[model samples]
Each structure stands twice: as structure tokens, then as C-alpha cells.
Target: MIDVRDLTKVFATPHGDWLKAVDRVSFTVAPGEVFGLLGPNGAGKTTTLRMLLGLIRPTSGSATVAGFAAERDPAEVKRRVGLVSANTGVYPWLTARETLAYFADLYAVPPALARQRIAEFADAFGLGDFLDRRCGVLSTGQKQRLNLARALIHAPTALLLDEPTLGLDILGRRIVEEFLELVQARQLAVVLCTHHLEEAERLCHRFGLLNRGRIVRQGALEQLRAETGLHSLHAMFLDLVGARRQLPVTSLKSAAPPAPLT
Candidate 1:
């Protein structure tokens, strides 16, 4: 359902420097499969996703989603894909039902079908009781549920999720996981970008470890585990990219103390 080949994106910095956020990355996500883009911050996952969604242009390479070229036929690509993110762009003033209806209109879903889908998703995601409540009044978990509902209102063929469970509690995360399982059961193609290895292991059939603007490893979960001789996804991730840690850089001036005390 999705094919990407040597995709790269470079941003020109104000300092006359070029920052390559994504470099020579390539992978394919088949129908009925959940593909995970696993990486740490600044690892190029978001840049690659934006390129695939046609939200940003790539410096080089190409990608196709649902048979439409991502760069050249973005409209066609958008029509076939649904997207949900941690910072889902939802209007705080709109009620949950209104939110779904609004997206339905954007997708040009038929009235009757839209109503039916709204009802189904609201109930499935436990948004029925709060359907009339304004989104701003909802909790973090409720808002996340509403985000997923909005994304599915049109029943797009593919899904792109960026940190869908990023700020949620345990219960909220489970709800997202369950919804994703349903998507998989329906043979929908899904590309998930996340830092949560456990979530990826639970939902994804295949995995790609992206590091330093490139895909360092790609394979099925079992294959990656076997090839890397790792017992768990976390172990495999650390083995492939090592652990991510912050380094504090202290200035020499700061280190030189009490110079005037004499």
C-alpha cells in the first residue's frame, strides 16, 4: 500500500548550512500490515512522515502511497490516507460529534454514511456519552479518542500515526492499541512513528529502526530479534542504535572559578 525509495529531505539553515533530516531512506508497507518507524528524537522519523504525507517536499528520492506519488500526486495520496497524531489538530470549541461531522464534510462522505460512521466510532471509542461536550472540556484521554474518531470518520484506506499515545496514561494507551488492532483486522495499511518500543511490538508486523536520518535496520519483529540476537524490542533497539542520552557541554569560562579571589 506504500512504497518509498531513497527518500531524502534537506533543510537550508539560516547559517548557510544544510541539515539533512532524512537521508536515503527506503521501505514498503504492505496492506494488512502495521509498519513501525522507530527512532529517537532528531532521528528523522517525523521528517520522513511529513514527506510521505506531502506536508513537506523532499530534497530527493520518491514515494508512493496507495498508487499515488507522494510528491506529485499529494491530493490523491491524501484521499486514501487517515492521520492521527499526539498533537491532533482539533478545534476546542467543537463538540465531539461536531468534530467528526466536520471531517466527514471535508472528506465529502455521504450524509447517511457519515452519520452511521459517527455513531459507530463514537460508541466503539467510548465517546457516546461525551459526544455533546466541547473538546476543550474533555480530558487528555478523551481528546485522544476524539482524534482517532475524527481520523476514521471517512474510512480512509491507510493510516499514519505519529506518537498517537505520546501523552496518554495506561488506559488511554490501551484504547489506542485496541483501535489499531481493529484497523489491522480490517486489512488496513498503517505506518506508525513512535518512541514506544512496546507499543510498536504490540501493533506492528514489521519494524524499521531509523537513526541519523537513515534506516539502519528493517525487518519483521522476529527476524530482527533473531538476527540481532536480542530477546526484546528494547534490547534490539539499543543494540542497533545504542541508548539515547543527553550530554551536557560546560563552557571553559564557567569551569574557571574564583580567578579574582586572590
Candidate 2:
């Protein structure tokens, strides 16, 4: 349901040279599958997502969400995708129920069905007790859960989650995991951008390891292990960085990104 090919984004640096935020990145997420876009800070994962969502235009290449080209059919693509980021938030003064309702309306969902989805999400996210409470009064976890529900208020075919489980307690993380499972059960494609490698291993069916704006390695976890002889995503991730970390600064800056997995 989500496809990106040669998706590149370049920005002008302060010194007037170009910086490639994302470089020829490519991936696909099928229905009922989660594809982890794993990387560290400044790795361009979020830039890739922003390009996919058409929030920012890419320098080149294509992104198609639910078969609609993001550059050409942005509105349709947006309608078919749900986005949840750590920064996603609800209106402080709006009641929890009101916030969901507002989002549903923005998607043009019918009133009756919107009410049904609101109820289902409230139950799924454990918002039952505070469904009528003002969002500003809700706890951190509560707000995060509400943000998750709000992203899916229209029941999009794909979900793009960037750091959805960041800064939360164990319970909050568990709830987010359960919610991802629930969405997968409904056959939604998911693109998860996160630094939480252990969580990614547990939740993602496949992963693309991005570094310095390029895909350094990508495949199913087992495939990655077979190629690298690394037992865990965390280990493989460290291996990739370790391989480059020892290089002198000049070589590191001039070095090309690792080749894609065959």
C-alpha cells in the first residue's frame, strides 16, 4: 500500500552547498505488513516520510501511497494514509471525544460511522474513563494514545508512524504495540520510522537500515542476519556504524553508502 522509489531530497546548506537529506531511498510496505525505516538521528527517515506524505516535495523520484502518486494525487494519497508522529497532538481545550470527532469530520466520515469508530478507538486505547475529559488535562500517555486514535480516525489503508512510542512508559509502549498489531490485523500497511531497534525487531516484518541519508542495508530480519551473521537488529545496526566509525574523517565524508542487499 506504500511504495517509494529513488526518493531523494536535497537541501541547501548554510554554506550554499547542497545536502542530500534522503538519497535514492526505496521501499515497499504491503497490506498487513510493517516495514521499519530504522536509523539514528540525522539519518533522513523523517524526510523520507515527509516526501511520502507530500508534505514536502522530493528533489527527485516517486512515492505512491495506495497506488496514488503522491506528487500528482496528494489529496487522494493523504486520504488513504494515516500519520502518527511523536509531535502529533490534540487541541488542548478540546475534550477527548471532541478531538476524535473533529478529526473524523476532517476526513468527511459519516456521523454515524464516526461515532462507532470513536467508541472502538476509545476502548482500544483505554480512553474510556477520560473520553469526555479535556485533552490538556490528560496524562502524557493518554495524549499519545489519543494522537494515535486521531491519526486513524478515518481508517486509512496505510499508517506512517515516526517515533510513535517515544518518551512513553512501558504501559504506553505496550498499548502502541497492541494498536499496531490491531491495525495489521485489519490489513493496513505500516511504515515505522524509529530508533527503537528492539521494538522494531518485534514489530516489523522487514527493515531498511538508513544512514547518512542512504539505505545501507535492507531486507527481512532473518535475511539480514544470514548476510551479516548478526543475531539481532541492534547488533547489525551497531556493526554497520562500527564499520564506518573507525574511518578517518576525510574518508568517512567521501565514502559512499553501502550497497543494497541482493
Candidate 3:
């Protein structure tokens, strides 16, 4: 349900030189797939997502979500995609329930249906205890849970999660993992951007390893191991970085896509 090709983003530095934040990246995520967009800080993972959300225009290339080009059919693309990020914001004065209802209205969901959806998500995420509390007073984990609920209010078909589990406790993380599994069961696509290798390993069917504005490696864990001769994800990551140093800065297509995760 998500397709990106040659997606590049360039920014002007103060010195008037170009900085390629994302360079010629390409990938596809089918319905029911969770593709991990992995990298350290400043790897352009977030930049790629912003472009997909139509928050920023790409310098070149194309991104399509659910068959709608992100740049041309942005409204349609947004209607079919839910976004959750660590940087997500909630209205400080609004109660958790109210916040969700407001977003549901923005998506044009009926009032009655919005209430039902909020109730379901509240139960699923264990937010009933704090549903009436003002967002400004909530703890970090509570706020993150509320953020997840907000993203799902309209029941979009695709999810773009950037560190969605960042502030959660173990229970909170478990809830999110369970939620992702449920969404995948219904054939929804998810793009997970995270620094937690174990989290990515547990949830992702495939991965795109990004570094210095490029997708240096991509594919399933097994495929990565075969290509790099590394038995572990951590080792594979180290090798990917190491290989980049040995070779000239160019795209490497060593890893092949694996079959969809069951």
C-alpha cells in the first residue's frame, strides 16, 4: 500500500551548499506488511516520512500511499494513512476523549461512530483511567498512549509510526505491539521508524537501513544475514556501516526481499 522510488530531499545549508537529507531511496510495503525504516539520528528516516505525509515536497522521485501520489493526492493519501510519532502533539486543554473526538470530526466521521471508536480504542490501550484527564497533566507514557489513540481515530488503512513506542513502559509497548499485530491481521500496512533493533526485529517483516541520506541496505533479516554473512541483526547493522566505508558512496542492492511474514 506504500511505494517510494528515487525519493530524494535536498536542503540548503547556511553556507549555501546542498544537503541531501534523503537520496534516491526506493521501497514498497504491501498491505499487511510492517517495514522497518532503521537508522541512527540524522539518518533522514523522519525526512522520508514527512515527504510521504506531504508535509514536505521531495526534491525528486515519487511516493504513493494506497495508490494516491503523496504530492498530488495528499488529502486522499492522508485519509488512508495514520501517523504516530514521538514528536506528536496533543491539545493541552483538551481531555483525552475530547482530543480523539476532535480528530475524528476532522476526518469527517459521524459523532456517534466517533464515540464508539474512541471507547474501543480507550479499552484497547487501557486509557479508561485517564480518559477524562486534561492532556497537559498526563504523564509521558499516558500522553504517548493518547497519541496512539488519536492516530487510530479515523481507522486509516496504513500507519506511519516514528518511534511510537519511545516513551511507553513495558505494558505500553506490549499494547502497541498487540495493536500492530491486530492491524496487520486486517491487512493494514505499517512503516515503523525506530532505533530499537529488538523492537524492529520483533515487529518488522522487512527493513530499510538508512545512513547519511541513503538506504544503504534493505530486506528481511535472513536475507540480510545471507548477503552480509552476519548471523545477528546487530552484527548486520555494524557490517552495513562498515561496508559503506569500504565502498564508494553509492546504492548497494545486496539484500533481496523476503516472502511476507506470516
Candidate 4:
């Protein structure tokens, strides 16, 4: 389980300005449930996840992951969490098998067990064809699969995914969805951060809609539909953020002119 309470992050700019990237966000994620942090770009979703993972210290409030305080016991939190991102951070020079082996070693898995786990995941994710191929040689879809495999090498209790399908085609997207289904079947807690409303609706049990550094609304899909009177998540998002205006840019010219020419 994960518990976040009034979490906040403030950045100090070079010009003596403070920017509030995350503003008093709070939410709880139970074991074995898929919870989504849905928002557009710059909506504080990444900041909130970073805080929960202890990548950056929060300016205020607290987060606990698997009953360990995120700030004080970041190592313990990391031990229980698996992270996957559009940028999987695998070394391009390393082969897929080597990459997985490297992370398994970092997690201190015994060499024998690591080898067994790598083989299991490679077969499950269909990486046998390219397990020995350098990461740089793999296609985008193949790389995404490798990324998911790497995250699962440790059999973590919680999974944190950030735009996992950012640069994939339809087939690749389906591959990711299928992998997610498998993860859910294992009853792993998942925190998914994605801009795709349909994907979230399909995978998440509940969702929190964030905007302008705050959680504007949150609930199950059915509850959101009932509360907003909207049938689709896309429509709910548009209504929450206000529909995009189609006004022309040239209409904003000012009438005032310079009084004197130097």
C-alpha cells in the first residue's frame, strides 16, 4: 500500500522566485489495485510521483510506501517498487540479457536466481529472439518490452509507470496492455501516469484528475461519469480543463502606440 498526505514540492528559481510544482496533493493506493494519476503535461503528476519515490524531497507533507516512510527509508521503498518509463534508462551498449542481469545484481539477487529470473522473463516477454542483441539495435516496441521485463526482474510489490506507451504503435500499445493485465493478475499495486484517457479507463480501478498543480477531481470511472454528467473520460477531461478556444492570434493587437521617437 501507498499513502500520500498533503504532499507538496516547491522549486526555487534563479531569479528568487518560488514555483509550486505540486500543491498539497493527497491520495491513498491500496495493495493489488491499479490507481492512475491522470493529467496533462505540467500538471504536477511527475512531481508527485517523484516525491512518492523519494527522488526529490518534498517541501511539505509525507509519503509512505509499503509502510516505510519515503523520506527516511527511501531504500526500503525502492526495494518494494518497480519503475518503468518511456525512457527505460537501459544502457544502449548492453545486450538485453546483460541489462536485466545488471539490475538484478543491483537488487542483490543471487547470481543463480537472477539467471533463472532473466530466462523466465525473457521467454514471457518474447525477448528470446533479441535477448543477446544490444539495446541500441532493438526497435522501439522491443525496447519497451525489455523495459517492462527489467522492471519486473525483482518481482516488486508496486509498479510505477510513466507514459509507458509514449512512442508505440497500435501493436506495441497492445503488447503493453497485455503485460499490464498480467501484472494486475499478480495483484500488484500499480500507479500509472499517462495522458491517454482511454488507456487509464481501461487499466485503472480508480483515477485522480490533476490540473495546475492540484487534484481537481478523482474517483472511479462510473463515479466520475455520474458526477460530471459526462459519458467518456475524454469529455470529462475537456470539461474539466475547459475546451480549447479557436480564436485567432492576430485579434490580440493593442491600440496603444509609442508616444515619442528617440
Which candidate ranks first by lDDT, i.e. highest?
2
lDDT of each: 0.89, 0.91, 0.89, 0.88
Query: What overall lDDT, based on C-alpha atoms, would model 1 receive against the true structure?
Result: 0.89
RMSD of each: 4.7, 9.7, 11.6, 5.2
Ranking by lDDT: 2, 3, 1, 4
lDDT of 2 by residue, 1-262 (tens): 8889999999999998999999999999999999999987888999999889888898999999888999898899999999989888779999999999998999999999999999999888899999999998998899999988988899899999999988999999999999998999999999998888999999999999999999989999999999889899888888766753565556676889899999
lDDT of 4 by residue, 165-197 (tens): 999999889888988888888878889998788
lDDT for 229 in candidate 3 is: 85
Backbone clash count, each prediction separately: 0, 0, 0, 0
For 1-262, candidate 3 gives per-residue lDDT tens digits of 8999999999999999999999999999999999999987888999999999888999999999988999998899899999999888889999999999999999999999999999898888889999999999998888888888888888898999999888678887887898788789879899999877888898999999898889988999999878878777776666656643554554456656678999
Instruction: For residue 92, give model 4's deviation from the true position in Å.
Output: 1.6
- Candidate rank order under TM-score: 2, 4, 1, 3
Name the weakest run of 10 consecutive residues (lDDT summed) in model 3: 243-252
Worst lDDT run of 10 residues, candidate 2, spans: 241-250
Instruction: In angstroms, give how far residue 103 of model 2 lies from its true place.
Output: 0.5
TM-score of every prediction relative to native:
0.91, 0.91, 0.90, 0.91
Per-residue lDDT for 143-203 in model 1, tens only?
Answer: 9999988888888888999999988999999999989988888778999998888888888
With candidate 3 superimposed using the best TM-score fit, by how many Å does residue 56's alpha carbon deviate from the native? Answer: 0.7
Cα lDDT for residue 217, model 1? 83
